[model samples]
Target: MSNIGVVSSCSCIHPLVHLLRPSIQKKGLHTAARLAAKDYYEVLVLGGGTGGITMSARMKRKVGAGNVAVVEPSETHYYQPIWTLVGAGAKKLATSARPTARVIPRGVEWIKSRVQELNPDKSCVYLENDKKISYKYLIIALGISLHYEKIKGLPEGFNHPHIGSNYSVHTVEKTWRALQDFKEGNAVFTFPNTPVKCAGAPQKIMYLTEAYLRKTGKRSTANIIFNTALGGIFGVQKYAEALLEIIKARDINVNYKRNLVEVRADIQEAVFENLDKPGVTEVYKYDMLHVTPPMGPPAVLLNSPVSDAAGWVDVDKETLQHKKYHNVFGIGDCTNLPTSKTAAAIAAQSGVLDKTISLVMKNKLPTKKYDGYTSCPLVTGYSRVILAEFDYNAQPLETFPIDQSKERLTMYYMKADMMPFLYWNGLLKGYWGGPGPIRKLLHLGLK
Candidate 1:
């Protein structure tokens, strides 16, 4: 019998609705024969987020749908890129959400539960309900963890009159409400000291708010402030130089080496600490505040065998395969990929990972590599964007003939309109393979 052939549920009739009931088994030992016999697959994916969805869909096509399974708990999936527009009231919050059932690839097995524990030694995973499933190959794409409580007074600060954050659907709409009601005083936006999914997201809203205020005639009355822990505006110097010019031209205050430590929503004040001078702290009064909270790899990865000291999956950065486990691969924010986390990075990683896994399945040495291609669409205003596409070395790998660091309407339309379609149709369907092909056609540069 082929190990990678069709798999069937023993008692469950509905493939999507029926789930493995809670049970405890570990290291492929001390498990009931019935449970162990019924729960096995050729390939197992550990997330339903961007990287997981794309890779699972691609894997299903390669190994046959019945041989693959994905473990994800959520029913609703959010197109997070559009949240910046949703928070600006330019796009409705409803546009960003979709039923997870609809987008999960046509035939892959969907286990609707959180992964409680990852066991690579036994090639099995423990679900939150305690049920266990074993697999020959594993893909880890569980993404990041958002820590709002780490900042003092956050759960309290959230939804306060002038406070807002675009990180969650619940609070995103509140940002537009706060922006619309503003009359005067300081409008503060903050970027945290830790690594976040989209490093540019913290300031994308700042620029949009500045534009909104100018359009609504409140720009003069309100002062725009961007407080960031980073020493500079952006990671890539070419883009950083362009962004500094933008903040200066718009008169938006840029405070480098400063971080938001607390949000005093009761008194409508925001507290900050100077990262350079450890003890120096300051509090600023605000009429409006947009916060980007600190983020990390999933909470489950803490101290796990698969994780690095920083709690990220320990993977070969170029191949995306786990450093110690040849059968395991990782993508997106959860992996120590040494690239800024973004959907664009996930898109590129998914393509590279999918191909490598297919080669490994065929009993071959995986030779594919991911070059750390990630893009950041810096939306400067309601109608303009600076699309920054680059590689591992901080070099501009422009997709178009024009300079990408400069703001343009065409790029804005791509971010505002084109990307969502590509994400929904091309990426989820396993047809989109990042922008490498497009870059080649436009620049005549091939490797």
Candidate 2:
């Protein structure tokens, strides 16, 4: 079928087609058609990451095969939480990633192309090659984009020695190598000012690095420093208190409101800006630096009208529905939902989003509301983890009946040995829907 016909068939009217020259639209349409395809899906999901794949599977179970389609570019799907363990030299980087083709649920169409544009008014999405796919209902799960180049002189540090970021699967091993090579001087870890996928990840690796250095008898020479852009170590008070105690005992320097703006690879210097005072800057010399780059929604979502001022999907927090469009829903790190962006949170959101979207598709009012549950497994040392689980109110909503603020080996075992299995075999398979049931069972009507 012709590209224009394919796009038009999906009920999408490209704004660029009308705004730009006819020749440009014609050319772009051909590209978009080849990229998107003429197939009309009942539920079209953009980005086949954790939330997208999970939702697609659930929708397929409800509607049947060929009812759902997922648009994603990469063939490899990464287990991002394991990057911390990889940086700590606890797990190999290779072990944390798998081919996307292997994990995408059966009986669903996978469009191996990047989405270039979104047309909510017309209920269609434009693909990179200029094809358009139409959907009766749409789910946005494109996830966040890591902007490493935003920091000046970062390329030099990332491409050179002594500086590494655990955010990517490729450079995660470099973090362990840098930690292993460090003998003395300041080992600096930075948390950017922007919202990150896992808020606790930047510091989790720091604690692990500190513990690794101590185990190797280099603790006396190494000065571990955590430079964060936030006002406190953690947003939650109970967990922050526990972390402060660990910092004092480990002799790690904690510098709050410090944002990394530049890196000087030749001299091993990192420049920082005080967020409170915009123009003021500070430079620290370091032997090793681990950077967490600023992140934001993908460019396609940012440029679309469906996006908020912050460049995230404008959605109602409770319903996960687009602010202006009733047919559109969002999940994962891409939405401007008031919650900590993590896979665990996404797991909880998937259940809520699935129920809400399904009801909306059937012309029924959505009764399900997301509680903004998020979990961060703060790996303090090689064998310990503080499982911080909370809701929007910052109250501890832990699954186990025990206190979760304290560092425990059981939590570490769960993070290391159990959660990965749950993530792969259960969560992705459309079986695991957070710990809602387990929480109720554990409480046993105590309230």
Q: How would you encode candidate 1's per-residue C-alpha lDDT over 229-301 as one tens digit per residue?
A: 9998998989999999999999999899999999899889999999999989989999999988877778778
My TM-score estimates for the predictions, one after another, are: 0.91, 0.91
Please give the range of 10 consecutive residues that has the lowest summed lDDT in model 2. 2-11
Q: List the residue pairs that clash in candidate 2.
A: 31-129, 31-130, 32-129, 32-130, 32-131, 33-130, 33-131
Q: Please list the Cα RMSD from the true structure of every candidate, rounded to 1 decimal place.
A: 9.5, 10.4
In angstroms, give how far residue 333 of model 2 lies from its true place: 0.1
lDDT of 2 by residue, 312-383 (tens): 999999889998999999988889988888888887888898889778878998999888888888889999
lDDT of 2: 0.79
Q: Residue 367 CA error for candidate 2 (Å)?
A: 0.7
lDDT of 2 at 318: 88
